[model samples]
Target: MNQIAPIRPDAARNLPQPAALRAGIGAVLDIDLDAIAANRAKLIEVAGGLDCAAVVKADAYGLGAEAVAAALARAGCDKFFVAHIDEGIALRAAVPTASIFVLHGVVPGAEGAMCAYGLIPVLSTPAQIEIWRERAARRGKNLPAALHLDTGMARLGLSEHEFYALANDPSNLAGLDLRLVLSHLAAAEEKDNPSNARQREKFEDLRKRLPKIPASLANSSGVFLGRAYHFDLLRPGAALYGIAPRADEPNPLAQVVKLSARVLRVDDLPAKTPVGYNGRYVTPAPSRIATLSLGYADGFCRALGNSRVNAGFAGQKLPIVGNVSMDMITVDASSLPPGRLREGDFVDVIGGDADSVDRIAQAAGTIGYEILTALGARFQRRHSFSNEGRLA
Candidate 1:
């Protein structure tokens, strides 16, 4: 058998920088790593001194988990949460010392790997509890895990009867070392919603029943529900990626991701010329149209068609016209001053001081969370960071 030779650290200096590869790409997703760290700090501040655990599930809401987790860990985020065992394993490799809690709990045969990797499972059912007990007994070792009780989410948690059984027979929790007791808030984002108080009351009741264990009852939206909602710890996901928890207030997060696409071609159209598929838009006058390299495949929704969306270029507002195609869209550049616009130049999709995730969401008839998470993976990604101080 032949063994592969290991490359020396000194040889890495000869490797080309990754950013240089994107020099010719028509589009790119610029990610701000510093914005992510600052977002974590803001979440901590909003938590009012409570320990904030970074939620890196769904690849950190599609913004790249390892990169996001590594940055957050450096910013003092010790506890992390993910939706699956694989995510836990990947995150463990990224931040070895950070405690990773698997939200989906144990799934049949995955118990051993969970223990081997030092990943804590959030047990949500009696079968999961049994599995953990049997695995711990077989290994002759106490496994760390958290118990998730269903408050009002009606998702991924033990029912009331299961909770009563666990409460009655605390020995069922034996062999398995319980670290944190948690429940999900279904409507924490809607501050005035009755479900928030109801869930909090139920969780508090459960905490009283299991007096020895520390309890967690908050998610991203729950952190804004005041100190009462902040128990032993708070897990925030979307807010860390610059998505606002509430719609009424100004977004407390900085722009962390920006999408930009280049102009593929420029065409001069006569008055009344139809553009794109279905002839959805007609030029009211002779117009100079620039075809863009972005479309629905890049996560720009088709519903955004027919809307007069603006793209910034050389301090001019270029209006989007006609239907958004699979890999292209047409923009009106007739108003662009001479020498200020040209083919191959990039247009901002999100980010910059002018265009924001909120504005994009508004134009798409959606929320900022959708706009950020829906961003596609086809574009080259660049991650950076900054410290802009806290909002007063």
Candidate 2:
């Protein structure tokens, strides 16, 4: 593995700090590192001392997985979850000492990489168990792995029949070294939903039947369900990135990702002039409309078109007008105090007081998870997670 070097002084001198960068056609995404650590602390606090495993899958939900994983590791996270063997390999290379778990489990020809990278696979089926056992036996090795029992989600994990079979036959895992027994809650975020209790009961019952193994049964939302849900460890994904685990409460997680776009052109139009495609919005009076560089292609959902969403600048609100286009959205900037707005100025799209992941999702008719994960790849990303704001 190539060793990572410290940031060069020359590079540091040339690069603008996250807050100083100007937003334009090539606006950068500012990732707050201190915010990441704070968010992790909040999650740990909410989990009531349960060890927190950071989920770095989907490129850390499209915010750059390796960078996010490294930041979280430095902040005291030891366990990490990735969706595939390749992700596990990459994360292991990035944070070599961190315990990595591949949620997709073992594939027929992929066991070699798992062993090489020191990754643990979450075994989901009897077939996977048998294959892993055979491979370990052939190699004269006892590979460590975890078992995921399907409680109710039915998406992954062992079915009820498979669970019973494993429980009835201890010899099923005779030569395999099991590390953790885990299950996912289907409706943990929904406070009134009965599925949470149902899944918990099933998971507990299954745990009782199996030989003593450290258990993990919660995701982000499950951690908020209280200490009863915290078994041996808790896996948190969205919460660690600042999205609230529960839908009904104010977010406890710090906002770690911020989106800003530059104003391309500011136009002063006459009263009642239409803006955007098909006259979706018409000014009631004379207005100054600012065209922003971001649109649906940039992950700003088109559903926000014709809504009353506004971007903030210098303590002023610029209301969005007309339909959002593929590359631009016009915002009424007339209310801005003179000299407070400009063509070169940037508008807040996600972070900041005017908009958040939850607010943007509400405007887009989607969920915060989708909004965060769907953040466009075009934006240059500036990641910072340090006490003094520079990578050590």
Candidate 3:
């Protein structure tokens, strides 16, 4: 089986502020670097030893790509994927030697920067292919690139007509070294969705016409669709960050994000008193309400207002009540004993349970990916390696 060189410990990055200083912050998002590495390991193992690449696009889903990608590199990951050229440029410094593939491919006239940074581009269109080919010719070298075949997503990648157009005349690819041929699965998470099989068959049919090269058809959820979708390389993004891999099955990945918010204020309200914007929720009886410092401004969805989601405190569920505002959320703490929840105390906004992310996303009528990437800059971010001992 193909493998990376032996794992090496990554040099520690700058540490976060002291707990004393963090106490003044309104919220904190604790990231488990070890969990992320383990998730990558799990994906690799499930892939039956096929190479697994980390997708750190959108700053590793807004959890700080520099730190997350560095940690993965320490755990023996040699390839990383990002959505744009700028993202690849920023991540280049963190994983200096690791293979970084820009998923969005090269923007016109930016091929020099891509080559200068030693970043590979996933060519998704014939136009992109021609630009990369032109650059390779000018440099007098076969520049590395990946071909994306659009099976069903209709989002990016080469369409069937475009792909066959090049396939008919192989000379179109002369100046580029095709590293990998890949596609995106539209509904791998659904498992029973027939589209998965259709896309796989299409990919198989399309790839056979090209020079023998590694192909990737799986994303995070695609990994769970079983070996049929594993292909030659596995490109997983959200799964490494602990998002559930499937909609119906229990999530097998470890939780990596823990979000908590400080209680800015606590109030006691009498029966029938309206709460928050437009009085969406009214107290039925005497109620203790705690105002959390996190709100929609911090990426807590306003749709969660008066939803069934709850703020966690010492295993207690403080049901979120009233509307989620720009900078505050009100949760009913009447169930907690007096003084249990006080000003300055912290409550779990998300990531308390194994499925907290999924649960919260469901309540907000969105997906876990949105919840993660939408997190704003207000929270004090900390990355932990508590599971490092296992990897060692």
User: 198-283 in candidate 2: lDDT tens per residue?
Assistant: 88888888899764899999898888887888899989898777787776888766687777778888888888888899998988
Please state every model's RMSD to the true fold in angstroms: 6.8, 5.1, 3.0
Cα displacement (angstroms), candidate 1, residue 355, comes to 4.0
Give residue 294's lDDT in candidate 3 (0 to 100): 87
> Which segments of model 3 are wrong by more than 4 Å?
1-23, 353-355, 388-392
Off by over 4 Å in 1: 1-18, 362-365, 387-392
lDDT of 2 at 236: 84
CA lDDT, every prediction? 0.79, 0.79, 0.86
Residues 352-374 of candidate 1 have per-residue lDDT tens digits of 52267777787888877687677
Q: Which pairs, if any, clash in model 2?
A: 33-384, 33-385
Report model 2's TM-score to 2 decimal places: 0.91
TM-score of candidate 1 relative to the true fold: 0.90
Give the per-residue Cα lDDT of candidate 1 at 313. Answer: 67
lDDT of 1 at 206: 74
